[model samples]
Target: MLGDELIALLGDRIPDDHARQWLADRWVPRFYATRPGGARVVDLGCGIGESLDLFRAHDPAVRWVGVDLEDSPEVRERTRGDAEFLTFDGAAIPLPDASVDLVYSKQVFEHVERPRPLLADVARVLRPGGWFCGSLSQMEPYHSLSVGGYTPSGWTTVVEETGLRVVELRPGIDAAALLVRRLLGMPAFADRWFAGTSPLHRALRRHPRLRGGGPRVHNAARLMVSGQFAFLARRPED
Candidate 1:
């Protein structure tokens, strides 16, 4: 599929709901909470390892693995032996095929110079029915060696090419809000990012049409203008 056909096909996968509460960027914590105990979860581009705390708080039974280009003193200091840490060459995940139950990433894909190899590796590591979920940059400005952002169509094409199915896509903060935050050089404004109370979202909340339009209408409007997006995809069951 190509062009509008592919876009329409992917659009169908987005869920419809009444509250539009899923627009919140809280998927990481919620995802951790919902997993059955003992789920093998991988943190792709684990950074200084903040997510481990969520695992500890939400689902202690998760077998956590942190993957990055190399280990750091901060990561070692923060995470210690609580979870295994591994390094990668940006092309492959070291885990065996079908070994991971869930792979979670956040604001990391934009740094990836090439995504296919790592994504294919994501597909390789995920067990049948396993999920890959994370947020990606869209209209945000450059930061921390940023490479590029992704549109909904761009995400669908790249992720689906790796044999994972795109299940849901939700918008994040508004583009203008994100850029203004960056321009003002204020970290305090960062709180709005995943907090789900960004300026545009606040405005949309009061809009009568969005208030009553249901999830599909709300999300379609939001995704068109958001600065970031989160996705949930699965490796099909064998």
Candidate 2:
């Protein structure tokens, strides 16, 4: 099987954080490198707009448009003046054809009930040669509130069918690291361990070998087990 095929077969079982960071590390650089000067970009299914904030921090000049089904109060508060957010109807997106230079999405496709039409919409809004860089889970637990659909050939086939060409495709995060972080409650430790030099950070860092071991292990184990997928594709310049 191909790399993406392997990931599609096994991504969900891997750790979530491992998957998240893997995507962040890979796509952040690509976005920074390819982001056109002062161009408009769209972020679909931008949960809480944290990624939008990251994109803005990377390049403040770019205009960002964010969309999601529901907006939490915290998300609303943080997203204020940062980007434009729209509550979308399930079928149609409120955007013009060939208007955006890039459309970034993460973990959004799997939940879409009508994936084809949604992707067609994505293609409709993207300008020629524009790109769509994002990640989606393959093997994962089902949260009724946040449903995901994993199909190895689905994304590529869909994009090609929509008349877009696959530019670059890379393996995303694995599942093991995700599980460990969740079990360890690392999100709660974000401010404590990751942000500053706290005791927990020192403890984890001192063990040098232990510091970044989870993601590495997760990446390896995911290739062995099943549940991870990520890719970047683009529309032809035509």
Candidate 3:
């Protein structure tokens, strides 16, 4: 179980629609709004650079860098010519201190075996007042395609311990719902259920609804029952 087999395994387990929505609505907008022109942004554990893609879409002027261990062919194909994607160890990013304005990661923290070093690296690379925006799966099944694992409270604790300020912590989709869907062998059902049959789907296609406070309230209710977590943090000004 390595390479493509591993990537496929993890990808299959994650709810695709939920992940995409998080990136487009939650993560991208949150970070990109803070960036000034020509700001350097690094997407740590970029996984195929989808998050980077979202950042690029938000602001094509911003410089984007993506780092990941498993640069799968699909990821390579998707990220080609859009931004810089590099293969590197997640714990030890290959960038100089205070070189970037933001470091964004999505669903990458739980898998870290030793999070301290990773946080140190993040603190090392980010400039004062730079943001480290991301999300982690706290209450989800144990599935890995890349070389990592999950841990609840780990991301928050690491940021605090490593001297980063906790800016905002938002609850994500329902993990229990996802688990049930997986258990029932129908992961896509929840998305269809939430989306319903609307002409909007034809326009957006596969992209999930990235707006509406109403949907967030409804999704939070579902998550309360399902048990999943997500958050965003930042490095303080010295």
lDDT of each: 0.77, 0.60, 0.59
Candidate 3 is scored at a TM of 0.69
Candidate 3 lDDT at 158 equals 64
In the range 1-238, model 1's lDDT, one tens digit per residue, is 1123433656666567532424323666666555678889899988887788776676777788989877444445654666788888877999999999889988889888879999999999999988898888889898877899998778888999999998888777778788888888857857656565577766776776655565666676677677887789999999
For residue 5, give model 2's deviation from the true position in Å.
7.1
Give RMSD (Å) of candidate 3 vs. truth. 10.8
As a whole number from 0 to 100, the lDDT of residue 229 in candidate 3 is 48
Per-candidate clashes, comma-separated: 0, 19, 4
RMSD (Cα, Å) for all candidates, in order, is: 3.8, 7.4, 10.8
Candidate 1, residue 43: lDDT: 90
Q: Over the stretch 6-114, how does candidate 3's per-residue lDDT look in tens digits?
A: 2232222222233222321365675656656678988887766676556667787878898877654445565365678777665889999999898887777666666
**Per-residue error (Å), model 2, residue 191:** 12
- The TM-score measured for candidate 1 stands at 0.86
Candidate with the larger lDDT of 2 and 3: 2
Superposed model 2: Cα runs more than 4 Å off = 1-21, 70-79, 176-226
